[model samples]
Target: MQGIATQLKETPEGQISLTDPDARSMATYGKGTGLVGYNVQTAVDTVTHLIVAHDVTNIVHDRAQLAPMAKMAKAALQAESLNAIAD
Candidate 1:
């Protein structure tokens, strides 16, 4: 308990995942429901249907993900102006 407390104190989030170091407590699409997982961001090309850019975050919410992913996809394609859509 003391060792875990020490580690948690050193952690930025003040919490630690003993099972999976990279995993985090994240909220899901359903209300009042959540899971321990990771948020994966991926940008896919329309024509090729291939993933152009990818990233991962421990963040629980995805509201701030679209713009960054769009920029990544745009930069990867080297396009002057690109259209990004998300549901």
Candidate 2:
């Protein structure tokens, strides 16, 4: 990532403020045109709240985040399978 950051800094690419400079930035899913950041989702257990699996995505609409969020939650919980409901 250092190499990529150095290259981006040396080029004409625009920059956006990220939570971490070393974190990977991906184009988020939406109708917008041009460069955008992705909104990643993660889920954890009720007891431990430890992150299991995470999805790297650029979904701008909260509406579409449900299944992915639930899936991540299930993975974290290590359940054979589960159902998720989001509002």
Candidate 3:
């Protein structure tokens, strides 16, 4: 937990405050301080409503997560390549 707190504190952009380390804003609901615990990503099939991929990260910024998460998701789904998206 302390390591995560340190990471959040040192992150340069969209640094999530650690005052309350277990809270976060919904993607389309409520107001958030751009602070909180984890960054989670999920990729679901529109047709089947099944989660094809997902990841939970301690880093705050979304910018750096794209490539890593995409790679992880591809590996998890056993896909050669993927068209990844995030918000």
Candidate 4:
């Protein structure tokens, strides 16, 4: 375990997850509340409420996912343009 510890020490984030290498620590609503997992992003049609596109990433939040997901959904549907909405 010393080698793993040493590698983690050298990393800029200083985070190491043994259970799942691809997962990361993510923040939640309450103070000191967090979870370790991948973030799942999905785009759906409002009328049909059917999933159009999806992506799994290790990013901690959804702030940066809107445009990329919209583009993906657009490509999936072969649309000329897309109007995306997020909360």
Candidate 5:
């Protein structure tokens, strides 16, 4: 798997998932812990608690996801504007 290793080394994150290329390593809340999986983002209705929108991404952090997830939720709801909160 030298080719795979080479490719992974070339990536900015220096990570590779053989089973699923879309999956990536994610840091955990605990120190020095991590997991390899897809980062799933979901938007739920405040009242109904039903999932309104969802997205699967390889991004390791949530900082950049707020706007995109909010936009997806807004589009799914067919709204002109949306008020969203992310934790």
Candidate 6:
């Protein structure tokens, strides 16, 4: 148990998964409900309806990922200025 506790302290979220080291706890839409997994963020082209930029992360909160994803999409599309829509 001490070994597991040590590992948990090393992680930013203070949790560790023995099954998948990279996986992290992610909360769902329901209260007190969550799962251990990764979050995938994608930036799709509105005009072409194709994926422009994508990323996978163990971090749970997606609210902070909007700007980074938008920038990556803009670079991938090679656009001078771009509009972003995120939920």
The TM-scores of all predictions, comma-separated, are 0.75, 0.44, 0.50, 0.87, 0.84, 0.89
Query: What is the alpha-carbon lDDT of model 2 when measured against the actual structure?
Result: 0.61
Candidate 1's residue-wise lDDT over 1-87, tens digit each? 999999999988766789998788786789988788899989999999999999999977788999999999989999998998987
lDDT of 4 by residue, 1-87 (tens): 899989799866678778988788888888998899889999998877899999999987899999999999999888998789997
Index of the highest-TM-score prediction:
6
After superposing candidate 4 on the true structure, give the runs of residues whose Cα lies further than 4 Å from its correct spot.
none
Tens digit per residue, CA lDDT, model 2, 30-68: 654444466666665556667666676544456777777
- RMSD of model 2 against the true structure: 7.9
Q: On residues 1-87, what C-alpha lDDT tens digit does candidate 3 reach at each position?
A: 998778877756534544754445324345643434677877775557788777787654588877877787678778887787677
Candidate that would win on lDDT? 6
Instruction: Give all candidates' CA lDDT scores.
Output: 0.89, 0.61, 0.66, 0.89, 0.88, 0.92
State the displacement of the C-alpha of residue 32, model 5, in Å, after optimal TM-score superposition: 2.4
Candidate 4: residue 85 lDDT (0-100): 91
Q: Which stretches of candidate 5 lie over 4 Å from their true place?
A: 1-4
* Model 2 stretches with alpha carbons more than 4 Å out: 1-35, 81-87
* Model 2 clash number: 2
Greater TM-score among 1 and 6 belongs to: 6
| Candidates by TM-score, descending order | 6, 4, 5, 1, 3, 2
Lowest summed lDDT over 10 consecutive residues: which window, candidate 1? 25-34
lDDT of 6 by residue, 1-87 (tens): 998888778878888888998998899999988899999999999999999999999978988999999999999999999999988
